[model samples]
Target: MVSQVDNVITIARPSETPAPRAWQRPFLKWAGGKYSLLPELDRLIPAGKRLVEPFVGGGSVFINSDKHASFLLADVNADLINLYQMLAIVPEQVLTFARRMFTSLNSERGYGIVREEFNAQRIDSIERAAAFLYLNRHCFNGLIRYNLSGQFNVGFGKYRSPYFPQEEIKTFANMAHNCVFMNAGFQKTLALAGEGDVVYCDPPYEPMPGTAGFTNYAAGGFTWDDQQALARCCVAAHERGARVVISNSTAPRIIELYKGHGFDLHHVSARRAISSKGSTRETATDIVAIL
Candidate 1:
């Protein structure tokens, strides 16, 4: 019931894992999802000081993170935050929403109705959360793409399926009960700083000059200016004694953006399988800041 109005960074060391619950599905099809790289995150940060993630995409890390100050989670996407809020606050509503969405997902008409329900209630934090899982379960490629105007644009995908599993709904709901979800910008979440808070930001990456077409998740272009602003906020948090981790493109400009900012740079491989031609895109890396 409390809110983080001031910036207090806390670094928490995660040495224990949460007891496993049933909800076991990734809701959204996040681009830089940490499902595979979880061990790496645990190794670098290890659930230190008040666990915080501003960008908390897909929640692979948050759900998996070692228990900290409960957990503080936030995101700019209203629908996404709604899902978290439903999970944290009123989990049964999420169950109803999930059941309704799944039950009505067979035909195109039913899918459209479900989508309408999601878009219509996206402004409601809890509903948006349940709708998030619903749409992501039914959307094509689990890809959460938005048009320039911010409309969910990805169509249905290959396999005839609904990604939401039966038991996962309740499991995820239980996990949601442990954290606080906010439909706010990443800064608000990062601003919540006290000693030992580990803040990981996976904001939209800065596009390189030569790169052609990249996936755009929001209506906003996630411009260079936004990246710069985020960098400044992160520096401020770091100065306040919070440990920070950020994932960004490997472009020279992106690398320079964090230059001398006190982050230990590590080159990590990324498989750009969005197009799924199965090609490998090397030179991807993660920037870790905790000094």
Candidate 2:
């Protein structure tokens, strides 16, 4: 059935929604992260042996939900995947380097130096992963944008003091045992979905009118063609016996795409902190489609 509801909010608290269980917060701050929308998503996600995410932005779904026995988390960003790998492999070492960076390199000049070093790839894998965590906290709005050349190009956030998510990092490290991180695009990742797997997709939202979309989480930005292909892929996975759920902007085209595919769509207001200023922060209309 095709369904659409405006300003629907299932999540308990808009400002701070506590998880049913202990919160497994991700270290990185993402633009369209699912941390706040977990309650609405949980209502839509079906039972499955494995939880698969093709566009695991900040990993809020997998980390928070205990419904799945295992998780297959994949993203197009290699650096992000690398950070997950390092955290899974060497938690203490990552914590050590990240702690040092957070304490010592908290300045705009320091942030610039680290950003250059991160792009240059001069450091080891563990250190590079730690550097990414540092950049995420200090960068403007915690954005991870890359230029056409694949260089991290976000400006420094002039926050008085950026927070160091040590507990969040440790929690992620502890939970990494049950997750398989992949540095792959959504196509490759969604192809792995099958019977008894619940695939949750949080792809970059289709840009709203008069606004340039924030699709540059990696080198090559996601495009309209990519959005169409992703919808097709989700449909294919659903046909293959996997229960699929997707989160995207309530853009006319996006709503039409899911409706045409026979998805059950629920519209909700998602609070976004993309803007640096408090007054500019607003609730955006987003859709949760179950297939």
Candidate 3:
């Protein structure tokens, strides 16, 4: 039976075992990351030949899951995909670069310089990857925001010291060896799913009442049309015999959209971490649609 906390639903499978390695943790600190939801999510994810995540934010699900199947991780953010690709191919180099940033250049001034350089878009792939990681770790609340011109604009978090995810990156690199990274849209990425594949999508959630929206991480933010299009993609993938799982806000429109398509919907309580006011960090209901 599914459990409910307030308006949130929780599904727990008693047979699931604990994760064996520490390396299974996500390498990045993402705002809407599913790290906290991993336990409940474990019950819903089905075993398949390949795991495809169309919106692999912080890769919490991918990093923690069993590695029996290969992975196809894609995101519309080219910088994010490029970082993952580099991590998969040259883990040691990436680790070295990150360590240098953490050890010698982790101050506010250092972060500002790197952020400026990254915004300028004049750096190479490796440097860009390193800067992405650095900014994400050092940025305010791990938020990745962009201006109308597609430049990173989040400010520093001002923490005395932020933890560098060296071990997490190593683990991600090792696991990513059997994975394919793509810088493509969700529809295109979901099209690659076929029979014996499992697809999990965690798109930007619809904003709750009196809360801020965060769909602008990319230049062109996800709109209502994009959400509807995503539903169609999930339905098509399921029709192709792929097990599809999607997570989004428990908005009325979202419920109507997935339910109209005959996808089984579940609810879960999600904590808001990116709000400007601490009082606004209340529990919010989210939906999990399994097709």
Candidate 4:
């Protein structure tokens, strides 16, 4: 059974149609991606005037949900945002560059060369976007990590071959034709979200105690302070009459932080995929807060 928050009445599943439209999927493989939870998210999402996502990692929620009156998608990761912007504006060119890289490179050696060039900043935005896509598809477990200097540092996955989602890219490009992309902090993005909008926050999960959390997706990794700032932002957005939803680890601090903030909280089971040990990769509870 699907988990729900805030006593939401689950919408009945629609009957099958003879020719159902193909659902678009996220083109990037993001850690902590919410693609699997789209159905639950769809139920909570009020019919939107605009959809604002400050942490649009992999864009799983955005791609799976219904098109809003408008969209404001932003992230702190410039390259990721640039990739989406380029896809929306110059998809054919991005696709061409991606195909060339995919056809000409497959081995660890080839990946190393591309990674070096990507880090060197010797290519144009379109080519860099294509390289980023290639690296994400072929990287180890689709983990996007950066070094202290903010360089792409994930190693190759050594797969026999990786499938490039050319059609998915085109689909997303068309879908995001009217969406606005920004490389801004979460607070700045949320500030633009106001009445008649839905804001979904999927910030990096608060790390478990005594463990170095996976916040290195970009420079200046998210900290507990950032988490508190986000909670305040969510409250501000709620006060402004925007529907807000947030996903985070079921950490005690997280539970306590939002408990008295007039938000409904529920726990849902989610898979842990980023673990290096197969034994450690198991289902865990994730908290969902609806305001």
Most accurate candidate by TM-score: 2
Residues 11-73, model 4: lDDT tens digits: 667676778345567888888988767766676777788889999989987877674767889
- Per-residue lDDT of 219 in model 2: 86
- Candidate that beats the other on lDDT, 1 or 4, i.e. the better one: 4
- For each candidate in turn, the TM-score is 0.80, 0.91, 0.89, 0.90
Better of 2 and 3 by lDDT: 2
Global lDDT scores for all candidate models: 0.68, 0.89, 0.86, 0.87
Residue 115 shift from truth in candidate 2, angstroms? 1.0
**Relative to the unseen true structure, what is the C-alpha lDDT of residue 4 in candidate 2, on a scale of 0 to 100?**
42
**What is the C-alpha local distance difference test score of candidate 3?**
0.86
lDDT of 1 by residue, 1-291 (tens): 333446765565666898754333464577667765666666666456577788877887777666465677887876677666666677777677667767766566666766676555534655566666766767665778777767777665534666566465565666666677777786677778656777878787666678754537666657777788888888888888777788777767778778756567765555453664445444355554343
Residue 201 displacement (Å), model 4: 0.3
The ten-residue window of minimal lDDT in model 3 covers 16-25
TM-score of 4: 0.90
The predicted structure with the larger lDDT, 1 or 2, is 2
Give the poorly placed runs of model 3, Cα more than 4 Å off.
Answer: 1-23, 209-212, 276-280
- Candidate 3: tens digits of C-alpha lDDT, residues 109-211: 9889889899998888887898899889888888988888999998888767889887777778778877899999999999999899999999998776566
Better of 3 and 4 by TM-score: 4
Sort by lDDT, best first: what order?
2, 4, 3, 1
